[model samples]
Target chain A: MIEVIRSGLFTTIQDLGRFGFRSTGVPVSGPMDQTSAAFANELLQNDPNDPLIEMAYVGATFLFNKSATIAFAGAICEVKLNNEIVRDRSVLKIEAGSVISFGAMKEGNFLYLAILGGFKTDKLLGSACYYEAVNGMARMSKGMRLSFQADHQQREINLNRKVIGLNRNNGIIEVEKGPEFHLLSEEDAQVLTQTQFTISPQSNRMGILLNELVEIESKEIISSPVQAGTVQLTKGGQLIVLMRDAQTVGGYPRVLQLTEKSINQLVQTRFNMDFRFELARESA
Target chain B: MDNPTVRKYGSKAILIEWEAVISPEINDQVVKTAQFLQENHSDGILEVVNSYHSLLCFLKEKADLASYIDICRCLTIPISELNRTRQIWQVPTCYDTSFGSDLVSISNAKQLSIEEIVKLHSTGIFRIYGMGFLPGFLYLGGLNKQIHMPRKQVVKQAVPKGSVAIGGEQTGIYPQSSPGGWNIIGRTPIDLFNAELERPTPFSVGDSIQFVPISIEEYAQIETAAKNGRYQLKSVHND
Candidate 1:
């Protein structure tokens, strides 16, 4: 068992997120940076979808109530265990009654702490992650305790072994123009692909509100059902990319849809990060 | 009647999009298309979600989409019975000062008496063009022309669940508590959304609804019943 002594900025448990429920307005509240989550698991050799701790830019602190093996990955953070400096992005063994603290990150945002056996939390709506607004799994709070079950088939890795590397988050995303792609003028669609949009301050799990670079001519249409990755054109003509937590239906015209791979990139962006899109690969 | 412009959505889905605003005619075709594909779709197909003017059908990555659409082409769908299947649900609303927050503002803006506003709302047969934005959040078309109002420019911090409100030309319940910008005219005690239940959405597309008047005292009883998860709107009625 581990007890959180200090909760950092928006720390919570997350897995691969709830899928197939976007039509019902449930957001996939999983680790924001899935690539790093996958990479952490790959280094620990844990299977994909392993439940882990997702934290905002500032990391958190915890007292190990019991002996356990844990690893940290994703956005690089300054870390210490029992007052002894520890390395980030490496698996380590900490005995019971030890305090672990993670200082603020110098760059990037969001980090993952993966336990060897994975954090044990009650699954909700088929997702291990927590939904803040709705009743979701436990968020990291003072005096909170977390238990992990031993994977009977756990693979042993060397604690002294290190595969440490630090890299700032960098990536451009791809998307397929969607249900309303044809509705846009040919020049508009061409401009959309050729344009670069910055993530607006009004971004969250539901979707990223993007700045308007090109004026999209929207034909007034009735509202309809939407899905994650659906880039809706608000009446004001800016695009809002509906994400895992997005509403099932939207009145905005869907101009583009981020490919699943690209969606992963946008959600994990650091402050002030910008990305441009390429037209989706046509079917072979 | 199928439009000629059909296409694949992605590796796992196909889309049938009608080229017009939502109409009973278009909505019926969407439902029939969903039913036909669900009945005739081959292995690897998982589910079909019907939209007001489109049908999004999911298939396995391995399933060839062109072949799936071909199979869809072969399906002989019985023309939709949307006009007949549409049920009028009379929702009892208590829009007195205690229950309706924006009624006074609405009355002032629309230049109508509260009683006149309620009467017009109650008489209108709003269309359930689609169910979305939230679970059981019915996107009702056809607000009384007198009641048609734009949404609040800024969303409220928190809107109570079951808020009967208007945004642009549509009216709907909040379904659950969340931030919203709609102009709330009244509230009901109905729980339009529940996660534990098998079927979460209370209304399906193509359904029609009417608002029935209720008193403050009845609102209290209904609200208590809803808190205990025992309230049933019993709203469906013959048109």
Candidate 2:
């Protein structure tokens, strides 16, 4: 068992996502940064889809009541285990009564923490991903005790294995022309590709809002299907990139769609950071 | 109806879009296409979400986009041959000012008496065009033109669950409390969705719904019965 000493800004347990329920208007709520969440699970030899703690902007302080193998990935932060500094992207063995605390995020906006054998959380609609409507809880609160499988076997530590660092890229987001992309005039399309847009503070798991607005004729489509990474143009010309927790259907015209990799990269970008959209070569 | 144009939505999903209009004819095609794809392509397809004029197919894993497009193009199910058994749900609603906070304002805006507004709302049988925005939130079409109103200029920070509201040509119930912009006129006591059940929502797309207005006292009774899992929603089969 692990006790949450102090719950951070926003934290939840997420797996790959909820599937087979989109027809019922269920959002595929999952990790904002899929690559990093999978990396944390991979380091601990757990299933890539195993449920892990996803922290945004800040992280929690956890007190382990039993021995466990764990890993931390995504975002650069000052993490300490029992007053000793620890590094991410590597497996760490925790003893009973060990306390791990995180502080002062240096880079990135999200983090993932994975434990061996995964956390024992109730799976709704065949997914362990936390969705407020389905699961009845949005985020972990202080003093919550999370159950996990106890590690009893003695394992050898591989000190010789080299850790591969995450590939951080420049703020260039790749996108494809959406179904309504043809509705944009040539000048509007040029502005979308040429201008640098900053991430707005109003952004959340539902969608990422941009600081800059483009000039485009606003028209409402018959409510149609939308998904994660779908860039919707509002009637007021605001661009909102639908994230994992966005609604399944929307009425706004879909202008562009971010690539899967680009979705993962964009979530890690902090608010106010400028990024330019580059149309994919194949799409162009 | 013409064939839907299949296009790539993202790396892992494909969009099959029909005519860019909202009508029963277009919605029927969208529903039929979604049903056909789910039944035939269960191996690679994860889920098929159908809206008014489109179907979004989520793939289990990335596959050849061209081939999937080909499969979608080959769907030749005739509308007549596809028989869909739909359910017509009778939702118990109360249009009192206590539950519907905007009832008086909507009555004043539409220049209709509160009784007239309730009468118009409950008389029409609405068709469920889509279910989205919130889980179990049914987007129903065929609202009475007399009571049709524009969405609120400023959205309410939080609209109560079971608030039956109208926006443009549509009317729907808020399955859960959420931020909304619709003009609230009534409230339902029955629970529309329960995640713990095998079937989350009682109704689906292509289903029909009709509001049965009840008194505020009946609303209290039904709400209690629903909370205790003693009330069964009244529904009928549309043959």
Candidate 3:
């Protein structure tokens, strides 16, 4: 068990997320930056799917009740264990009652902390992830006891493993045209595929309401079930790119949808960064 | 022979849509393409999601889309066979004044009595066009034009779970409480979503539904029974 001495901005518990019920309108609420989560798991050498603690913007200070091996990755979080500044994205073995603290990222929005054998929590839909705001603090809170495997003595975090390799690159995300792409005018379509758009201030885990270059209209498409990758054109013609926690159904015309991998990347993006769309055409 | 509209969806998906002013021909083509792709090309396809008039066939980025389109164009499922496989269903609702929050609003909007509104709604069998928006929020077609009503200008902050409602020419159930603009006319106690349960969704696409009106007292009885997990909805099928 780890004790939270301080709670930062917004942190929460997350795993890979609940799937298989998307057609039923349930959002796959998972970690915003899956790369971070996966990297933390790799550091601890835990099963890739094992549930971990997901922190956001700012992080927390934890006092380990017992000795354990843990690793950190994701955002550029400054970590300190027992008042000694520790390395980011590496595994460590700490003594019982040792304190671990982390600070806000200089450039990112989310982070991940992984432990060996994963965190223990009541299973919701076969996943240990807390969902739909995880009752809100974004993650763990002050004085909260986070249950995890502390029995393990030590583990190795490969210093060789690279973080922010291919996935975290910002500015351009790959997308496929949605079913109703033809509904947009030629200029709007051209602009949508070519012009660089900025992520609007009104963006979060739910979706990114982007500012597109040209004017467009939101005609009612055949009402259907939408998924997280859906990018909808609002009545005012701005684009709203659905994210991990987006609603399941929508009526607006979906102009384009990000690739599943891109959606994972978008979850970790720093706010207000200008991003452009890159058309990824699968060759015949 | 009907011309089917073939369009590319991203690099991974291709949508084959049939143009139809009326009838279920387009829907049939969509489902047929879905089945053919499912059975014949599962290796190349990642997922096949069906809409009202088109099927979204997801593919691997490296695969050949031109060949995939050609394959879909050549695929065929007999119209009668497709209809035979389609499932029609009935969903019951009681539009009592207490449960139906928008009963008065809808009644006034259409310049009719609550009794008339209920009669018009219950008189027609609705077609299940799709399932989305929220878990189990069914989008039903075939509404009686007499009770046609628009959605609320401002979405209610909290529409209760199981609110049977109407918007424009469509009627639906609010599977779970989320922000919605539909004019609710009744409430059902059955939960359409439960993260704790397996098989969370109650309905699927291509199903039909019917509305059965009940009184406030009867609504309470059924709602209580459903809450206690003892209620069972009755359904009739066509041969």
Candidate 4:
């Protein structure tokens, strides 16, 4: 078992996501950075869908009740075991009674910490992902205890893998035309590709707000199904990139949809960072 | 009408748009398409989400978009052959002053007596256009013109669950407590959404709902039964 000494900004237990429930209006809540989350599990040779702690901005401090093998990935953060700083993307061994803490977040918006056999949490709606108060606890609070599988205890395991040769974090985010893309004025459409927009501070799991205002000529469509990576042009001319936890239906005019790879990169985009959007298929 | 315009939404999904307008016929077509896809799902298909006039198909991997487009273009919806059976639910609502905090203000705006407003609302049978945004929050259509009112100028930070509200031409019940701009006129005792149940929502898209007015005492009794998981929501089959 692990006890939370001090919870960070927004820490929650997440898995691959809550699936097969969107039909009933449930938002799919998962790790903001999918590649990073998967990396942590891959190091331990565990199921990628196993539950792990997802932290926004920075991580938390925890007390390990038993010796466990763990891994950390995403966001160049300072993770320390006791007073000694540990490395990222490598299997870590923590002794019983050891206090593990993550210090200042250097870059990116999310981080994932995974145990060897995954956290033992209640499987609600076929997933261990924590959503709002309806299914389970929303976020980690101080004095929270998380149990893990005790049987799969490996003493000495060497992992020499690292997240190498991936440049998805920075660059132009690729997107495709949405259902209502044709409704935008020619000039407004051109501006979307020509101009750069800053990521607003008012971003959450639901969506990321862009600083620039878009000039859309079309009105709101009827409330329709919207998914993660959908780029919506609001009535106030603001552009919002819906995240994993976004509502299933919305009324805003969808102008573009970020590719799956772009969404993975989007979660790492920090606030006030300026980025441009490029068509996924330039010919199309 | 011509077949739906199928276009790739992203690398993992495709959008099939049947119409730009909202009507029962359009919604039925969308539902039919969703059902057809579900029955004939290819290995790469993940899930199909149905909305008012379009269906979003999420795929596991990249499939032959050209072949899928051909399938969509040649596909024909046999309206008569489709299963038209639908469930009509009589949802109980309490319009008492204690439950309906915005009743007086809505009454003043519409210039109708509170009892008259409730009567008109109860008599009208509402159609479910969509079931989304929030869990079990039904997007309903069909409201009495007399009771049609704009949403609250100031949105409520938290409206209680089962709050029956009206926002312009739309009237719906808040399945769970949530921030809303709609004007609450009544409250229901039944739980529109319960995670424990295999089927979380009692109502689905394309279903019809009728509000039945009950007194405060009856509301309490039904609320208790609902909490105990013994409330049998009054429903009937409609073809």
CAPRI band for model 1 = acceptable
Candidate 1 structure quality by residue, lDDT tens digits, B1-239:
55634666644677767866667778777766665665656465766656678766777658887888776656566545233455677677877766678888888998999898888888888877666666567767778777888899898998887788877777888877789998888888766766655555556666688888788898889889877978775666555
Mark the regions of model 1 whose C-alpha exceeds 4 Å error after superposition.
A41-50, A132-143, A150-154, A158-171, A235-237, A281-284, B36-43, B60-75, B78-90, B235-239
- Flag regions of model 2 displaced more than 4 Å: A87-89, A153-164, B78-81
**For model 3, how does the per-residue alpha-carbon lDDT over A31-125 read when each residue is reduced to its tens digit?**
77777788788776788878888777788888998877777777776788888877533667778889999898755667788877788877665
Model 3 ranges off by over 4 Å:
A3-10, A61-63, A82-84, A87-89, A124-126, A133-146, A153-170, A193-196, A211-213, A281-284, B1-16, B20-23, B32-47, B57-74, B78-90
In model 2 chain B, where is the ten-residue run with the lowest total lDDT?
A: B73-82
Indicate which candidate wins on lDDT: 2
Interface RMSD of each: 2.9, 0.7, 3.8, 1.4
DockQ of each: 0.39, 0.87, 0.35, 0.70
Candidate 4, which segments miss by more than 4 Å at Cα?
A: A151-156, A159-169, B42-44, B62-67, B78-81
For residues B102-193, could you state the per-residue lDDT of candidate 2 as single tens digits? 77988888789999999999999988999888889888989889988899999999898899998877898999888999999889998887
What is candidate 3's CA lDDT for residue B235?
A: 61
Q: Tell the DockQ for candidate 2.
A: 0.87
Please write out the lDDT profile of model 4 over residues B107-181, one tens digit for every residue: 899899999999999998888877778877788888988899998889999999999999998899998888999
How well is each residue in A1-284 modelled by candidate 4, as lDDT tens digits?
Answer: 99999899889999998777787788778888888899888778789999999988878999999988888787767778897877534567788999999875677778888998999998777788877734847799999999999835654556555533233546588888888888877788888887888888788888989988876655879988899999998878899999978888889988888987888888888775778998766524
